[model samples]
Target: MNRPTVVRTRDELRNVLAPARRAGRTIGLVPTMGALHDGHLSLLRAARQRCDVVVMSLFVNPMQFGPQEDFASYPRDEERDVALAGQVGVDVVYAPDAAHVYPPDFATFVEVGGGLTDVLCGDPGRRGPSHFRGVTTVVAKLFNAVEPDVAFFGQKDAQQAIVIQRMVRDLEFNIEIVVLPTVREPDGLAMSSRNAYLSPDDRVRARALNQALTKVLEVAKAGETSTERALAEARAVLAEAGIEPEYLEARDAENLTPVTRFGPRPVLVAVAARVGRARLIDNVVVDATPANEPMAASVDTTGGAPCVGRC
Candidate 1:
């Protein structure tokens, strides 16, 4: 296995990637906070297939987390992350420190415009607005620093993917954004770093997110086009599971605007809920045309059918 060369500073990162760019080789970047998991590796594998160099960034941006959120206890294992990155053929691990990323003099932040972040990113008003702002800012900075030919994001973060895609188009970034399917656990729980916080009971209840989303797919497949009915049924599925759903609504897959009725364009059925201490989000894009069957629901890039290995 080719071990990845880890760099913690922006200067070191540029020094490392400079030659690859000068050599006229394509670069692929997978931006992530540390604590590597199967979902994170899937992104790297996709990047590996397309680019000569695959760079995995492991920085836990303080800005993305709320004051009461898990920034301090959000799980950090740098040594293990590097080992896992190597196993997946990652060429570079760009792990920058908080101070290094945001110097004492740093003041500017990137805010995605056009009210794109009004809904998701942990319920705007309840938490500070900085979550999405921080995500966009850090992404902008990473784009500037790494200068990747292509960048990858998971479909699990459906809204974030949409937000970033808009930012790229609005700001005119040259990098291509690719959103892959969401990877899930054997029992159908969407894989997430925060899954570590779920208690055994919560872990079991957390499967409801995927279960509810699955029902939406089943509803669409059954030719149930009532957006109101499908969404209500999904919420009832969660209610039956005894999970507290935050938001389960139908929206245009691309813009995330509320959709009263399904049509030719794809409808993104997204849901966020709190099963335990962990707040989980999962979504599936269903073709509302009634003729076309439901497409790939979540990001399942295991390179096989769901439950083939994990189950």
Candidate 2:
């Protein structure tokens, strides 16, 4: 078994992929922050299907975390991450440190605007702009370093995926951003590295995030056109379950404009809430009429968050 080559510096990564680039071969990049899960594996699978080679970047970004957020304690197991990447047929593993990525004079950052940095969970102080700023900065660096033909991001972080696509378009990176459906646990909880913080009991309550989102979809599918009604009911569901609902938004999946009352537009119902030690988020794009199937396609394909082990 030939293990995936481990790269520790930007120069090394670029050199590793140079041959493929020169040969006009396609490459897919799956950027992740360690703590491998089925969700990350799903991204790997998506990249494998579309490209000639796969490069999985594993680095926990401290810039994305807030003052008191779980940056230092974020889950990390590079050994395990690399092992799993090899299993999924990853060709190379690029793992860079802060010094290598953001040297002593690294004062510049890539920020995105157009109201994307301040909507839904990415709002002002509640881990929105700054969080996304860090995400985009790291992603831009990765895109430049490897210069892959395409990149993959999971739908579990629906807003993140949208924001990244916007950045790529605005900044004009010549790479395609492909989003796969959100991978979920058997119990409906979205698979996340943050899930490691959930205790056994917290794990059970975490399902409420999915439950609340699902109820909104059910109501929407049942001919509920009132955006406020779907959001309120889902909020109530979370409140009743002792979960603190942060934001519930119904927006056009394309431009991400806020939707007042549902209509013919593609609407993505997204929510974020604090469940125990974890902050969970989930969304589903509902078609206009009740007879229509759910819109899983966000910026590319179509359908709602797909269940794992079944799709």
- In model 1, residue pairs whose N, Cα or C atoms come closer than 3 Å (at least 3 residues apart or on different chains), thus clashing, are 181-299, 182-298, 182-299
- Alpha-carbon TM-score of each model against the true structure: 0.93, 0.92
Give lDDT tens digits, candidate 1, residues 1-311: 78899998989999999998999999998998877678888888889999999998988888787777778998889999899989989999998889998999998987875655776553565453567788889999999999999998888887788888999998999999988788878888888888888999899889888888888888777788888998888888899889877778888888777787767789888888877888778888887555664564333436211110110
Model 2: number of backbone collisions: 7
Winning model by TM-score: 1
Best by lDDT: 1
Instruction: Count backbone clashes in candidate 1.
Output: 3
Candidate 1 weakest lDDT stretch, 10 residues? 302-311
